[model samples]
Target chain A: MIKRKRRIETFSFFDHTGICKHLEKMAVKGWMIERLTNFGWIYRRIEPKNIKFEISYYPKASEFDPEPSDDQKTFHEFCAHTGWKLACTCAQLQIFYNELENPIPIETEPTLEVQTIHASAKKSFIPAYILLLILSVLQCFFLVSGLLGDPIDTLSNTAKLFSTVCFFILLIICTVELCCYFSWYGKAKRRQSKVSFINRQAHLFYRKLSLLL
Target chain B: MPRAKFQTLTEQMFYILLCLKDECYGLDILDKVPSMTAGRVNVGSGTLYNLLEQFLDAQIIRETKVEGRRRTYILTEKGKDMLKKEYERINAQVTDYKNIFEKEEIV
Candidate 1:
């Protein structure tokens, strides 16, 4: 018989250390992360064991790619030769595990690791936030114009009222997400010292939401 | 862009470039670094892998050959110059360590 559990995975893009520590704890409890789902991570029961986890950002990798590209394959092979076994991957984040005692950590050069993370985020959240900002701005422009042009009719009509409420919700969400991204980025840029992200509480909220689902 | 800052590379970066001074496969570096440093320094695979990519991008190293799953790399001219500068910088630091043995010496 196989026992399994689903838990929301909390990984603030900058808090790689936190996620790795979380996984290490899970391993201590005999739960190994089996797969990533839309909501969170699903774990399968296993023998309680100590394992070292490492994460790397592969900017060139795509989740949609049918097969590992030649460069990625070669890179993995090199890591394998060094005793780190590939565990799982989500999008561009590659995770590896090692059962060996006190293995050397994957990220050695602190400044380079920080630089690589910034480069990856440039390709990801920066564009996402910008697009969201543009969309919400357009949404606000239309809704505000309509309200001002004909105050009585705009407030009287249910359709316009519904859209006004929807746009406001979107605006709030976009603003919050942008703030969260930049705040974390700024703190993470300092590097070296272990940094905790402010979005941890927000992530815990999502984890609870995922648990219900 | 301060030339002096970059002219001095981290221990791992210095050793990685030194390892590629001889044409060798990527995997070979995994073992070579520890052995050369007499176990004092260890370069993790992920660290080494990413460093190799950065080196390739910066033209510090070039892929010499690919044999099946293993790819060999060698230092380029730019890499050699950088490595030489780093070597000289470290030597200069040791040469300047005249006050550590004498407490009376002041900056």
Candidate 2:
């Protein structure tokens, strides 16, 4: 019998609420989140139970850390005191689980939570998006210039046209993601709102489909 | 843009400052809050951790001791001042409620 499972579900880095909800649903099916990896989210089979999942961000955490830093350990200790135990961590994102019924939430202050999310997002999400956006723009510019320079050659080659379409889709995705982040950050300051960068499942599916094409 | 840094304190923040009035361990705030409020208020550990950092940045709280990861903190004068202001603001709301409702009772 299989004891572990891995699934690729695209949950945006900022979408902790969404991730937590999904994990809870998984927990009820006797599979608990064990780790997050480049390949997928790993789950280990467990006795079916209702458990709560929480995500917290530590902007200073890095993937290169050999172990939890002193401050991170301290933070974990505090959470443990209230029934929230460390489940796993991926870079700045720490996932915690509590078996206690109605455990106190890991984040009580919405404003502070939003600030932490933004700080974490700036560390990873923003830079990646910026790099992807630059890449897409450069590729688009080169393709357009090539078409203008030699319309017959560019149009006739199926590969160039496909590359152009893929890069155009990438550019749109990057632009929308960056714009959504900024807009959400701006509104988050004025009022409390759930942190989300839009569901990326469909976007990811399209990207994969484009890659295959 | 982010509320001018500690202009108002949330209930959790208020309780955290109350816990730090005397030198206290950072993790102790997690338990102290709920008991102090008779379990009416609880500070999430993550919230407490981040708030401590933010309070330190704003000079509202200062580290008193560090026994490895078990650090101690105490509310600074600024933190005390903010707590007092929040107390007064809450008090004023209660006073307004009594002023209106008490008069209505007489009528």
Candidate 3:
């Protein structure tokens, strides 16, 4: 029997570390992630064991591609050669898993890793925000014009009312998601600076400025 | 881009470029770096991959060969120069440390 569970996880966008850690804990308890989607993570029960999970951003990857591109395949092969097994992929975000006792985490250069994630987020998330902004502005324009032109028709239409509510809901979600992404990046950048492989001058500058203040 | 960032290499990058000095496969660097650093520095797969792309973009490294699912690369002239500069910078730091500590101990 293949037992499965769906966990609603919209907040994964807000918290990358939290989501990866949560998935690792789940894997520890014998539930392996069978499917990861915008809807939620679907897990299947397995023999109880520990597994290591790593999340990485591949700027070149795309969800619409019928197959993983040559570059993506080469990347996966290289990772497998180094012991990380590709667990799943959602758009630009790729997750790898290892059952080894102590596997090297795939992202060693902290500043580079943060920058990679930021670049990927900019490509995927920022566009959605722009689209949402345009749609909301258009919707509001239509709503206002409709009310001014004919109040009864605009208010009486149930479909438009429902869509307006949904548009607002989506707008709220877009705003929150964008905010969370930048906030998470802000914190992640600060954390990465500690273990950064480069950018010592920038770090020194920041320290000196903070001291001066 | 400033000239200084090009003048030095991070530990991860130094080892990476060092291993690629003789035209090595990408996977080989993962194993070679740990041994070279005596298990002190482990270049994670993602980091290595990204750095390779960045190096290629920056023309520090050039793809040399593609053999049966492996891609081999070697440091370019620019990469060699960067490595040499980084070596000198590290040596200078060590020299400065020895001078300061040894002189203080003598005093």
- Give the C-alpha lDDT of model 2: 0.86
lDDT of each: 0.76, 0.86, 0.78
Give the chain A TM-score for each candidate: 0.77, 0.87, 0.80
Cα shift from native, residue B33, model 1 (Å): 1.1
Estimate the lDDT of model 3.
0.78
Q: Which ten residues in a row have the lowest lDDT in candidate 2 chain A?
A: A203-212
Write model 2 residue lDDT over A55-160, tens digit each, in one string.
9999999888999998889889989998999999999999999999999998988888888988988898899899999998998898889878998988899997
List DockQ for all candidates. 0.55, 0.72, 0.50
Q: On a 0 to 1 TM-score scale, where does candidate 2 land against the true structure?
A: 0.89
What ranges in model 1 sit over 4 Å off? Answer: A10-14, A152-170, A191-213, B1-5, B99-107
Q: On residues B16-83, what C-alpha lDDT tens digit does candidate 2 reach at each position?
A: 99999999998888889888989999888899999999899999999999887888999999888989
Per-model TM-score on C-alpha atoms? 0.84, 0.89, 0.86
iRMSD in angstroms, per model? 3.0, 1.7, 3.4
Best by TM-score: 2
Docking outcome class, model 3: medium
Give the worst 10-residue stretch by lDDT in candidate 1 chain A: A204-213
Give the lowest summed-lDDT range of ten residues in model 3 chain A: A194-203
Q: Is candidate 1 or candidate 2 better by DockQ?
A: 2
Rank order by TM-score, top first?
2, 3, 1
Residue A43 error for model 3, in Å? 2.2
**On a 0 to 1 DockQ scale, where is model 2?**
0.72
